[model samples]
Each structure stands twice: as structure tokens, then as C-alpha cells.
Target: MAHASGMHSLEFKLPDLGEGLTEAEIVRWLVEVGDLVTIDQPVVEVETAKAMVEVPCPYGGVVTARFGEEGTELPVGAPLITVAVGEKQPTAGTGDTGTEGSGNVLVGYGTSEAPARRRRVRRERPVSGASATAGQTGAAGAANGRADAAAAPVDARAAGAAAAVDGQAGGPATEDGPVPVISPLVRRLARQNGLDLRELTGSGPDGLILRADVEDALRTAGRGATAAPAAEAHPRVPQTPGPALAAPGSTTAAPAEVRTPLKGIRGAVADKLARSRREIPDATCWVDADATELMRARTAMNAAGGPKISLLALLARICTAALARFPELNSTVDAEAREVVRFGQVHLGFAAQTDRGLVVPVVRDAHARDAESLTAEFARLTEAGRTGTLTPGDLTGGTFTLNNYGVFGVDGSTPIINHPEAAMLGVGRIVPKPWVHEGELAVRKVVQLSLTFDHRVCDGGVAGGFLRYVADCVEQPAVLLRTL
Candidate 1:
């Protein structure tokens, strides 16, 4: 849609922040309404389930409208902002409207000169008499040198339908035009549930179908009634059949329920942990080890070297060596194929508790890295976790996990395996304890080590061997010398 002043509005939706993230919480807005932005400029900071990221704008122009406020969670493909572009506007320093935006969606992508392609042109159609007047007023404002005029709200369903008719935002043309569904996940969900996309109206911007729409459609179908009526009839019925809520408008006093929606990082963690518990028949074996030698080795290494080696790094090195001895523990089960997939390279993930939630950042090819390199990588990932800067790539593809819960002052825990991975090695706190060493009684720094493995991947023997090797390294640090 173009204004009389030769300016047109382009809606920039939230692009797919990879690793299958569906939504993000708006943490902050970098640009305000009417702010001039160049292509690829960071316009908003959003917190996805995995990390916090600054979403860059692909269009260069005056930001005419801001869509969601800070703290609002929006699905992917939701409209983020509307930019008004004109011949006078800066098109990524070209100052020509003919040049398209810098093809960058996320950070570290795109270029100065993007390929020239026609922008998504909104087909002009009258939604209502009031809509026509609103459009005219907006155009007049632009023509009268008012570049800050807020965009008129487009009837998203109507515009989506129009876009479908024009073959711009649809899939597989039909008599009623193509379905205005862009997300393949949404299509798959609908297909799996035997729901037709054409019958349901989308709640997203531009009438694009979303996963929530499919879920809602399924829920309505299961209930055999419209959502509004069902919701009104049983307003307090819990969806998953937990405790029954108090009757609506009941005079009886009930405890005030403070419900927090599990959506972002918490929701992701919940889903993964639940899946791990549901699928993996896991068993944990723990052993107490005298870690006096390992601690002394770390201190000596730090005293003799340029950089200090973290205790966690030494433990990680031990884990890599242990995994080398028993690769069965460093693998995943292909449930569909019913085969155990062992990895040659060990991508070691360490659990770090952040303000967001529990996150496991993986160090790629950890088996090849020495103690020093492992220390550096662990420090980098730990700092990234603390500052909420760990990317999706940093958080995934782990063949094995090392969780050091000692920082939390916990003795030991049978940690749930990180889903799809075969096993997790948990390290407890090292503290002073009495022990007999070399036929003498003395106090030694003792630590408890636990290995939790999927029972299907390996038997008790393999799991015990892996744990014994790790314990042996902790007890005698010299055992790592052979591997070195």
C-alpha cells in the first residue's frame, strides 16, 4: 500500500530464530516510533528460550509503528514493526526505494547490497467504510509531510485472504485460493490432526496460520463446541485434569491461585526434561572418590602455568578420557530405528544454572581439547550463560553431559539425562572427610561422582566401567597421564 507522498508501509515480522524456537519475549525495544533505522540495524532485543538476541531490522526507513510492548511474548512471523519507505528514505545508504532491504534477518548475516526483489505489496481493498477513511487520513498525513503518522491497523484476515488470492502468501492454489499458511510446522500439525487450514481464521498478522490456531481448532473439535462457549460454561476447568478449580462466581472463599505461564525457557526445560523421563529408562550409579590428588594437580598446574585450570575442566578432561574408554555411554538411541548411535567425536555439554533456567552449553569436539583448552571453553560458555549471550548453536548437539552441581552446595543427585543423549555425569561438592589412604587414616578431600545412563543403550557393566574410570582419574590424577 503506497501513500500519496510516494511512501509505502512494510511490515517486518519476527524472523525464525533457529533451533526450532517458536516464540520470543520482547525484552527491550532499541528503536521507538518514528525512529530512523538502517537495514540490519538492531531494532529490538528479544529473549528466546535458548538465549537473548538483538533482532535486526531488514528494512531501512522510518519506524512508523511498534507492534508489541516490552515483556509481551509474540510468536514467530508476528509483526514486529512497520517501516514507511519513500524515495527520500535511506535504503541502506542508497537513498533509492528501488533497492530492497539488506537480506539480513539475524545477526552475522546479510550484506551491504541486497538482491533487488519486489517488496510485499499490500493489495488495496476496502475492509469497511471506516477503514477507507483511516487509509485516506494516513495517506493525507504522509502527503502533508507528516512522516510520523502511525500506520492504520490492517484487517489481518482480509489482507491475508487478499494475499492468498494474489498468490503471495499461500500454498497450493485451490478454488478458494491457496491456504495462507507459511509455517510448515503449522501445516504439519494441522495435517497430523486432520484439520483443514482453509476452514479456520488465523489470529496472526496477515492472517498467517500459526501452531496455536491448529491446537485451538483441535481443542474445539474435541469438545464439539466453540471455544468461547466451552470456556464460558466451564471457566475454571483445568486443561490437563489436575485439581478442579473453584466454581465460577462462587461466594465461597478459596485460596488465590497465582499462576505463571510456563512459556519461554522454563517451558522448554519442562518439555525436554519430561520427554527424557518419559522415554529413557535411566539408572544412576554413584561412587565416592578421594579427590585430594585432582585438587592438588589443579593447584600445581595453576601455580606453574600462565592460566589457572578450573576444577570443572579437570573433571571434563577426565570425562573425555572415560568416554574414550567406553564410547557406549557417549551415544544416543535411535528409537525409530531401534539402534544405538554412538558418536566418534564427543561434544560435551555442561549444565549451567542461569537466571533464565537450567541450560546445557556444549563444547564442540571436547575429546580433542586438552585441560587448558577445556578450561577456556568452559569459562567462555559459563560467562555466556551468566550474561544470557549463549546462542542456540552453543546449547545443542551434545553426545554427553557433565553436570557440576557442587556449586549449589549439593552432595549428589541422580540427574535426568538430557534428552536424546545417552548419559550424564554429575559431580558433587568436594569437602574434607576422613579416609584411609595407603594403609593410614587421614582426612582427604572427597567428592561423589554419579553417572546416569539410559538402560537401553548400555547395561550396568558399561555404565559401571565408565564411572570407575572417571573415579580412578579423580583418585589418582596420574591415570590421565597415560591418555595424555
Candidate 2:
């Protein structure tokens, strides 16, 4: 629904979805052209690497145009929808930059809730064809019940291509023309990283820019910078194009094999783990715990007529308590600043495997939640993970992680640490094992516990102490009662 000529509308681009999520696939659209919508109304559903989220429109007016189609993967800051805000509210101040809002921050960019940002002047630009079309058809269609709008849908990509040719992406770098990027996220990325977009080429349709292009340039520059000192210390050499693709007619003997692209959530997880392995010097320590009393304690509590406590929630409670005494394990190493940043609040992340991939959903301030509340939140987040409705915020902000791989029926594993986080506690299966109980050979419920910690954050003594405390709590449920 491109706006018609003489219509004043504001175009909304996709917002940043957090946790380094730069792009998402549009799963579904909640609104259609000619629809009158209010601010903060969810207009689209998008799926990112970690979860599915509904993106809301920031403007209130008639929806004149929508960009992209279902399943289209759009970078942060791509055009999402255009709204006839100025036309809908004639009595409001018409200052050129006055793009008033409800002050709710979306993923891509945030708006100030203060009066100054609320009353600022809007930038004046030539009307896009979509806007012009929206203006003409909107007035006519609104009177006739939107029949024309329903009959003919606007193609957002085609209009963008047209805009590119007409120089609507922006005129010259400054005066009339602007950079082809419409996303503030991309601009902010470049600005914060000190990247110059003018030196790079866009990989999007019709020379349109994208976030990936900027990121690639940044990486290249970083490599060059590191090589600069080496080059100065050594000798300079002329660069040459590497071996040509063995001529088009060339053939080589290679075995047939299946290949899969590492992408989306799986790719993201791979990159993080690889970097963790490369950068963090980690060590793992394990201990076998007798959990006969812990199981009895849970059973007695359940039989006493209270909310049923989940095993994971109980383990999480133990973790939060353990972190309190061993705060050194609940911190990250800041390589840039060479500082150890410790957090007071326990943002506990738990590993849950989903159809898409493995995701860690965080429970913010886990130290404050009781067993009942923890159980409820764990259930909610696990369900959200399985259903693909978890948001980016739900997957980040963790000071530590609890990996219960026992659900898969494993005894023990030296798991890779989730990067930036200093430690991960792994729990194995609880099964009956012969033990010396009460000075006699007897069968008792036992479990294996392992702690993987960054050596930079803590020594083996502290890590051993944390693991021993957790194991003690498992063997004697009364040990945790002391903390309460």
C-alpha cells in the first residue's frame, strides 16, 4: 500500500532484535494494506536464530505500504511498513521532524520518552512512489471500503527497485541523495564500530546496503590492522590473485559426499563455541554425589500438598546458592579492558534442545525466585523454547549456565563453556549405585556433577570448592536448608 501523492507517511524499518541478531525471516504478517492501526500494535512475526518474536509498528495511522513477503529474510533496518500518521491526525503539530511516538522501544531503534524527542522536527524528503500511490488510493479506497486496496496489492521490492532508479534511496551522499541504507541499526553499527560505509559495496538488491557488508569490512580492516605491525617489522611484498579456478573444463577426482550449510541458530552456536575454545583456557572437574536424601526430600515436600517442584528448578536453586558463595565463577573476562566483570544478580541460563537448535534461555535474578516460582518460570521458558516463541532477551544476559545433559541419559560429559560466561554446571543421571552408607554396603541414588570454569576467572581451588558444595547439597538436602 504505497502512499498516494500529497500523503505524508513515515516508513518504519525493522528494529534490532538483540543478542547480535542482525537479520530475521518474516514468518507472517498480521496487518494488511488500508488497515487503520495504532502505535505499538504487533504487525509482523519474525523468526531469528534463537526464537520467534512479533515486531510492533511504532506509528498510528492507515497502513499504506508493507515491504517484503512472508519468508523473506530482512536485515535490521530494512523497510517494514509505511504509515499515514500526518494524514490521520491533522490537529497535531506538523513540524517536519515531528514523528511523535508512544515511547516504546522496538528492536531496531529506540525512541526517547521525553518531551524533547517527542516534539522534534521531522526530516522532509521527496515522496516515494509507494507513498504517492498510497495517498491516491487510500483516500478513494477509505471512502469506498478499501475495495481498490484489496484488489491490487503493492509489491514492496518492485517499488524499492523503482526508488533506486529514481534516486529515492537518497540523493547524493549529502544534499539530495543519501546512502541506500534505510536501517538505523546498520548506521548505528557502522558508527559505533567506526566503520565507513562509503568505502564498501552493498550486496543487497539494486546496490542496496546491508549489515553483513559492513561487518565483513570491519573484519577485513581488523585483520589488516594486526598485519600492519608485522608488515612493518618484516618486509613488504606485492599481492597477486591466487590460483585461478582450475579452468572451467578442469576436473578432479573427488568422492561424493553430503554437505549441509552451517547457518541460522546452529551457525551462531558453532561460532560462539569455536571462539570460546580458541580464547578461553577452561578446565573441568567432576564429582560423584549420593543423592538418596535429595530425592526423599522432594517426595516429602510434594506429599505435603504444595506445588510440585521440578528437578531442574531444584538444581537451578542450588546453582544460584552456589554462585553466591563462589562469585568468582559468576563473571566474564573483558579482554578489551583487561578487567574481570562480576555480576551481583544471577541471570541463570539453562540449555534446552529444540527442533531448530540448542538454545539457552535465561532466568533473570534466579537468586530471588523460590522453588515454586523457579519451577513455574522454568516450565514457561521450556515451553517457549519448544514452541519457538522465545524472544532474544529470553536467550541472553546470563552470568552462568546450568547444563543438565542427563535428560539425554548420559553419565557425564566435559561440555564446552558458553562464551563470556565464566562457568557451566553439568548434571548427570541419578541412578542407584552401590555405596558405603551407614558403614555398610548399600544401594543409593547417585549422580555425577561436573563444573567447567574459565581458568582466568578462578583457580582450581575455587572451582573445586564450588563443585564440592554443589555435590554436598545433593547428598545432604539439609545442607541447602542452612542457607535458607
Candidate 3:
């Protein structure tokens, strides 16, 4: 695997940061070309749709090259860097080579050991030398005695033809040869859609096919291109006509416009909100509650002088108690399985608006935590969100969400339910208002509480019950004592 220069060149690809993420935008590069990096040393920082993460290099060596520059977006398996090591390293976890990699790659991914063996279809014929050479130019080649093969140029049209032939052959074209694919998810997607993988030229490094390539091909076929040749020949689909050109001699000018791409955290929020609106048969119900007693209780707790309890923590405690009384609200609807999935533990998510955008960080096992515990956790997650250090694990797996839009100085809002979660409890700002307390007209603290829930999970009776219980606790604060 050593090249004529006496250094073994190994390509490191962007690892799959879990939670079904497909791509990430490079925020900054930590190392430069010719810099020496140790195994498991962070080499770059990337921002995915979920969170910002620092990606570590698994192999220790001189950085020969870095792939995409900052602000460039790359897919899950695209090449991130190339390292020239003094000795050949065993392909991480594959044991196909002689060197060992630093097993850890990302928070939830590693390369310490080989994966479980999978059944591979054997190719009936030997791969043609041209196709084999093209395959070796990818990340796969670094494992199969072709570490330096990337230096060779690959012909795109010929590789596309070989891929087409391989598709028709019903298996790989060569025995354990390069198919130019690395992700099983990509392969499964192509197979499920009946798309021929070999027909499209990959846009990835060394002609390695990426998920984007398959998606683009699918989009092209959807536009009436039936065959790969047809798709390749007519790649551009006609776009809708824009505003007509100004009259040749007219003094009038077109209006100025500024457009922003909805991406990153903003894009993620948009997609989830749209999906929730489209899929969930959601209903919203609100009620005005006297929060005077709740505010008094919080003030009294602070006066006692333990770690000061947060209003959010008090509200979170109330939410947990209300969920316990009406467990139906703490569930999700599984449309595909035609069932309601109820969780045994409560992973509570609270909406936090940061400089980046709105993010919901979950408090694991919120139901089991006391007010003090919940306060500490809420503070930790809120700080993380503000600094943009929250991880994917911090952002997902919420059975329910508590949205406190009150911080925006709003009195009330009917929040959109977080997708896949059955319900969201919205809290509005508490302010003094006229109230008839105990048969007398007086000023009292009041707040509006709204609950948005998926109708498929429960009827109005259950939703109303849940909301009423929350309001009752907010008005009296003693109703939550029994649950404590």
C-alpha cells in the first residue's frame, strides 16, 4: 500500500454521526495540510441539522490533503481528509489491513472492532481492469491493497457503463471488488426504489456514489426520464419562467429582493413544523388560570434559600404530575404500525430559543427528578443551547414537549406540536389582571395555558382533563402536593 514516495496514503471519510443525519456543513477546519495529527484528535468542526460537532480523525499521520473547505456541505461518507502514515494501518475495525485505528470516531460511532458479518452476493465474473481501477480510486481502495490508487484518474462515462452492467448482472461485477458504495442505507434506498446504481456517475471523491447522487437520479426519473441514458442526456429540468424582462426603454426598475436559504437549525425547525401540520390531526385547547399561588410558592421556595428554583422548573414539575394523572397525554401515535406507543419513562423536552434558532433539549427521565434536579438539568441544557454545544442526543427522543413562549413577552400562543410527539403544553406569560377571587373582585396573577395534541391519540375528554389538572395545579399549587 506504500507509494513511491514511501508514505502510505489513507483516506478518512466523514463518519456517520447517528440519529439518521445525512449531511453536515463544514464550519471550520482544525488542521491544515502537512500538519501532524494523532489518532482521535479533532481535525474539523461541522454543523449538522441537529447540532454542532467536532469530528476527530481516527488515523494519526501527516495531513496530506483536506477535502471540503469551510462553509462547504458534504454527505455522510464523503472524503474528509487524506493522511500519509509512516506504516500501513489496518482499515479501522475491518481488520483488512495491518494498522489499528483509534476506535472512537464520534459520540455514538466507533471503529474498535469489526462489525457483525453480513452475507455478500458473490460476483460471477472478474471485474474488468478499467472498472476495478476506477473502484480502487475511492475510500474502499484504501482497504484493498489500493491505498494509492486514488492518485489515478477515473473515466466517468466508462465507470457509469460498468455500474450499469453490474446492475444488470444481478450482483457485484467482480468478486469483492469495488462497487463504489460505502453506506448500506444508500444501497437499500437504491434497491427499494428500483434505481440502477451503476447508471449514474457519483459526485463524491474518486467517483464514490453518495446518497445525494441516488436522490438526484430519482428526482430526474420522476420528471419522466425512464432510462439512465435518458437521465444523463437531459439532466436539466425546465424551471418556471421568472418575472418578465423590463421593457427595453422603460425607466421603471424591478423591485429589489433579498432571499435567505432555510437551512441548518432554521431549516430543521421548518421541516418538523410542516410535517406536524401535514401529518398530525392536531387540535388546540386553551384556558385562563390564576397563577398567583404558583408565583407565591416559587417566591417562598426562593426565600428558604436552597438553589433558587426556576419558574420553568416549577412548571415542568406541574407538567410531570399532570402527565402522571393523565398518562394518555404522554404517548405517540405510530401510523405505520396502527398503534399508540406509550413510553414507560418520561423524556421531557422544553423549547429554548437561542441565537441560532429554537431548539428543544430533552431532560431524560424528567418524571423521576425532583424540582431541584429538574432546575439544574434545565439550566444545563439551556446554557448548552445558548452556546450551541448541544449534541444530537440532547435534541431528540422526547415523548412530550413543554413550550414556554412566555419568555418572548407574549401573553399567549397556540404552539405547533413537535412532530412525532403526541402533545405539547404551551405556557404564556403571567401578568396581573382583574379576577374574582373567593367571591371578591381583586387583582391576581393570571396566565393562559394551551395544549395542542394529536386527535388520533385521545379525544377531547382526555385532553381537557389533562389541561384542567394543569390549570388546577397552577391556581392552587397544593394540588401538586399529592403527587410529590
Highest-TM-score candidate: 1
At residue 14, candidate 3 shows an lDDT of 85
What are the RMSDs of all candidates, in order? 14.5, 15.7, 15.1
Q: Tell me the lDDT of model 3 at 372.
A: 94
For 50-146, candidate 1 gives per-residue lDDT tens digits of 7767787888655656777665787998878877655443544342444577667963245555433223333334356777667647644543432
Winner on TM-score between 1 and 2 is 1
lDDT of 3 by residue, 357-441 (tens): 7899999999999999999999999988866678999999999999999888898887889989999999999999999999999
Candidate 2, residues 1-484, lDDT tens digits: the string is 4434434567788886777778877655666664445566667777677676777677765565667666467899777877655433321233233347555546533233212111111123435666656655654554344222322343232233233222243332222234665333355456545677777789987776776787787676752211111101122343443356555544332323323334556667888899999989999999999989989988988888878998888899899889999999999999999999999899999999975579999999999999999999999999888766777788888999999999999989999999989999999999999999999999999899999999999999999999999998898878898778
TM-score of 2: 0.64
Candidate 2 lDDT score relative to the true structure: 0.70
The stretch of ten residues in a row with the least summed lDDT in candidate 1 is 225-234
Best by lDDT: 1
Q: What is the full ranking by TM-score, best candidate first?
A: 1, 3, 2
Model 3, CA-based lDDT:
0.72
Task: Report how far off residue 306 is in candidate 3 (Å).
Answer: 2.0
Q: In lDDT terms, how accurate is model 1?
A: 0.73
> Which sections of candidate 1 miss by over 4 Å?
1-4, 88-98, 107-257
Error of 2 at 168 (Å): 33
Give the residue spans of candidate 3 off by over 4 A: 1-6, 88-99, 107-255
